[model samples]
Target chain A: MNISGKNSISGMLKTILQICFWGGIAFLILLPILLFAIGKHLNSFVYVLYPNGICFLIFVKQFIELFNLLKENNPFCNSTVKRLSIAGKAAGIISIILGAETIFNIIVIKDEITSIFILGFMCILFLGVSIALYILSELFKQAKEYKEENDLTV
Target chain B: MGIIVNLDVMLAKRKMSSQELAEKVGITPTNLSILKTNKAKAIRFSTLEKICEILECKPGDILDYIE
Candidate 1:
């Protein structure tokens, strides 16, 4: 449980940022496939693509914040970085839920059982990831407190 | 909540600057500042040991029980 202060926060931030970056790329790359499997074109929907794009952008911003902090080794930036990470995770979860809903609606209206099952599975996976992220946040907060006390004692 | 870092006193007794101590302890100056300012989340035993060695002091010299 005892980790170097520099390593612990940086390690967590790095992992979270990497997930966000890759997750964004995965969603963007799969957009066309998802739309095609749903048997719809983006041009047919007005606001469907934009929400996912916005969430990706937020995640990228957080990634940048984390990168800057890592480079500067700034302690003051840790809280802000953690906050932005939570915000990015929240946005990602919301966008995933919305995307699932849209896909589900399309599948039901089109009587497509396969797409419905796939989207439902994806929704479940997203829920799992969101829950894990929330738990990690709480754990990090506890670790932070524990580290504070240890630092004082030393 | 009960333990406080008496780093300021140790630094004064040793005539050491935070930056110097940070270098000796192998931590960033900002981390040292956090420790000195009572904002750090935790410290490693190795770092604490380094600080004590550099300051020519014991753990008790740098920490105190607060009422």
Candidate 2:
């Protein structure tokens, strides 16, 4: 199996990310209408939804960029590390947004405790993702340094 | 960064072109250019040995240290 190329695992992951990204946009676009159709006692979840969606889109975009680097077999570069750091920050923002939304749901919505529990779980999940992304960024930084040194050893 | 590559000086003294040296050293011209421009982080002993052998000079002749 080729690791880096037009036809590779990273390429597959990139395609999946693109699907998730565009699918997310479509879902965001249709969400208000869907909520309207449901006609529940929900008060202005749009604010929370949009911010979280945008953060998720940004996070996915960063991964797409990182996968582009992987496709080029140039993953061990400064830009990859920078992209990972940005993705990590985006993930952190997502976690914060989810945390706030969870609190808001508990205070204002006050209907489904199960949904709130899910939101809290999601908040913790994104926070873990954020920390994992930061660790990956650090790993990439070290790998980039080592690659530079090795490339220069001629 | 304090270490300087004196490849040009040795190449000039030997009356050899970088392309010729790169060809004889079995390395790419881009790698040779990297070393020449001092953008290289380190030199492998094997590559240094090849360069020294090709140029008929010591490693010290191609590398210099500056404060």
Candidate 3:
């Protein structure tokens, strides 16, 4: 089978995503310990980090699956659609959590406009990604049906 | 699924094995099995023509409409 450049790129991206996945896990586990060791306390740090870390991990997993599909040259299969849908749902949940965090920040730290803006921006970014992924998943489903029909057309 | 593929019946009537028909029709045996088992979603005109030519039969001989 002739491997396309797309597969090569996806393979590289899969490696990067795997690195990010493990790095994120390590960061999440060590952040609080590091903060305590440094004698610094930030009440919202752990709370924000945990949810965002989980969401990022889920996104990395979805991308890993997607890259594997590309490597297999079966990007339009049902599993790809499922992974995209899961990614979309995870992003949606992350957006909601970010929105809630923004509200909490606004109420608790009234003068921290920079942090609030950043949180709000991330919320919108994740929401947009969620919508795009959901649409892509639908398109993938249609493409998968077409591929199945074509495969059986012989 | 109202359209049924009767390829196996036609092959049996012509005293032909599926593997032999598949070789003559230039399709994989797995694909011929798909058509024979009525699992195929669609058939190409070229493939149908080849199958008909090899089986010495009409397209309708290998396909049937069942309501």
Candidate 4:
């Protein structure tokens, strides 16, 4: 079938939506790493520091690179993005559980707890960002469906 | 400003069910139905090439100028 002007506009819109959804997800994935790196730097002031601190930043940077490659329509990026999103979700859930544990310890243990609070807050922030990424991943999946349907008509 | 998909014609010519075509084309039957009904918004060259190859017909066999 001929792709008329209307079809072209709608196709472009779908492509734009796909980009926005994935780009938004990439930003959300970066947010937690950014927050954690900053938190780690601040922790150095209080005689408490994070172990494996830089690893989070490095992993997230790699994910961002994958996101860019996906934007370029690299075939490998399709599967890689799905895998990284699952990994990101698991990391988020772990962070959230750790945050809850820290909060519980602060309440029950009744010790000097300002540092625990900071870490707990950072974990909660990461959880929020991670949830946003999950939503964007769902959006990407939906956009893929839309593209497939559009493809059939042409 | 009008063209119509003759997907049904191609499918009938090949004696292929929409579900079977969808399986071969790697798309769902619902989408195949939409294409057959001329309700689809776009088509990709690669997908068209695959469909034409499977149906053993030219693009003209499955598409018609409507206006």
Candidate 5:
């Protein structure tokens, strides 16, 4: 199977990611309006989702851009490195926001312990993912440099 | 990067054009331009050998080291 090209794996993945991202965007836009129609208020949990969801969307958008590069058969380019770093930073921001929300839940709102534990767990998970993405971005940056050097070697 | 390719000098000495050299060496004109413009990071030994053989010159005649 081809790694990159018009009909390659990366192209399929890019299409899938585009579907999910647009679907999620639609969901993000419609959910609050639907809830408001039923006269629902902005609960703490729901409010937290807005900020974190935006960050998550940005992360997915970066991945979509990276996959676009792969589909173009130029995965080892500067844009891929930039997109990966942006995605990593988005993940890191999500971790920090979740951590702050968890703290707020414990101190101000006094949410249930199980809920707090769940939020804390998610915070740690995102932190781990953020670190891993950052490492991957660095690896890709080095790979791009090596690829440029190799391409110039004639 | 400090290693400069004086391919143009050797080509001129042989009274050959870049396009002809590119074809004779089995490489693209774009690659030849890259080498001539010093944008290439490195060159393969085989390509160097081919260039030397075609130009009938030594590698040193085409490559120079500048501080």
Candidate 6:
């Protein structure tokens, strides 16, 4: 009964993430078609969207797993650690893609210097998040070991 | 494997059921099972004291060391 509110909130978050995951998939599928409908050419700028979309989906997946762990009241288990690690890798991949995209944009579009700077900043920011998540995953792993030892102590 | 619990041997010598000992020790049957099966990571001093008191044995009687 005490955890009912927490479970409800986790359920709500899972639902939202599920919606985002599917919506992102649909958007990725429709993006090129919509661009073509507007008579716009698909360029290197458009190529970057594919990896970004995939990274967003991966993040949704990571959050869904996290919400499931919260719902089960086992947020410090091995699965949670694995999910965090996966999310960290996903963010790292996204950061790499953003770095490449920034370089491509700088060469292809000379007038978008400010936008390119913002993209480079995002790359650095995501790299930091990835490292932080990796460290947090290691901490969770130690916590899980401690919890198991405590559970068995009695 | 340095510390081994001889809980099963003690239980058998005392002619007591695991459920009975569990109830007396105020621990769940599952936890007693963990101890008996040597699946527990560590034993608490309080639990060791309770088991010793209930079984009328020293901690040494219920634990052994192996090389």
Worst 10 residues of 5 chain A by lDDT: A3-12
CA lDDT of every candidate: 0.68, 0.88, 0.87, 0.65, 0.89, 0.88
Per-residue alpha-carbon lDDT of candidate 1 for residues A1-154, written as tens digits (9 for 90 to 100): 4222544565666677777777777777788889899898776332554565665556566656656654665533347438555754865565476566657467556646775666567566656656666676566667666655765543
Better of 2 and 4 by TM-score: 2
Q: Model 3, which residues run further than 4 Å from truth?
A: A1-12
Ranking the candidates on lDDT from highest down gives: 5, 6, 2, 3, 1, 4
Off by over 4 Å in 2: A1-15, A37-42, A107-112
Q: Between 2 and 5, whose lDDT is larger?
A: 5
Q: What are the interface RMSDs of all the models?
A: 4.5, 0.8, 0.7, 3.3, 0.6, 0.7
Question: Using lDDT as the measure, which candidate wins?
Answer: 5
Query: Taking the candidates in order, what DockQ does each have?
Result: 0.16, 0.83, 0.80, 0.31, 0.80, 0.83
Clash-forming residue pairs, model 1: A147-B41, A147-B42, A148-B41, A148-B42
Task: Quote the positional error of residue A75 for candidate 6 in Å.
Answer: 1.1
DockQ of candidate 5 is: 0.80
Of 2 and 4, the candidate ranking higher by lDDT:
2
TM for candidate 4 is: 0.42
Clashing pairs in 6: none
Residue pairs with clashing backbones, model 4? A154-B42, A154-B43
Report the error of model 4 at residue A14, Å.
Answer: 27
Which stretches in model 6 have alpha-carbon errors above 4 Å?
Answer: A1-12, A107-111
Shift of residue A7 alpha carbon in model 2, Å:
7.0
Residue B55's lDDT within candidate 4 is: 95
Q: Could you give candidate 3's per-residue lDDT for residues A1-154 as a string of tens digits? A: 3333643455556677899999999998898899999998868747877988898899889988787778677788889999999999999999999998999888877747998899999999999999999999999999999999988887
Q: By descending TM-score, how would the candidates be arranged?
A: 6, 3, 5, 2, 1, 4
Cα distance off (Å), candidate 4, residue A81: 5.3
Candidate 6: residue A25 Cα off by (Å): 0.4
Q: Distance (Å) between predicted and true CA of A142, model 6?
A: 1.4
Model 1 chain A, poorest ten-residue lDDT window? A1-10
Q: Candidate 1: TM-score?
A: 0.46
Report the C-alpha displacement of residue A143, candidate 5, in angstroms: 1.0
List the pairs of residues colliding in candidate 2. Answer: none
For every model in order, the fraction of real contacts preserved is 0.22, 0.96, 0.78, 0.65, 0.78, 0.83
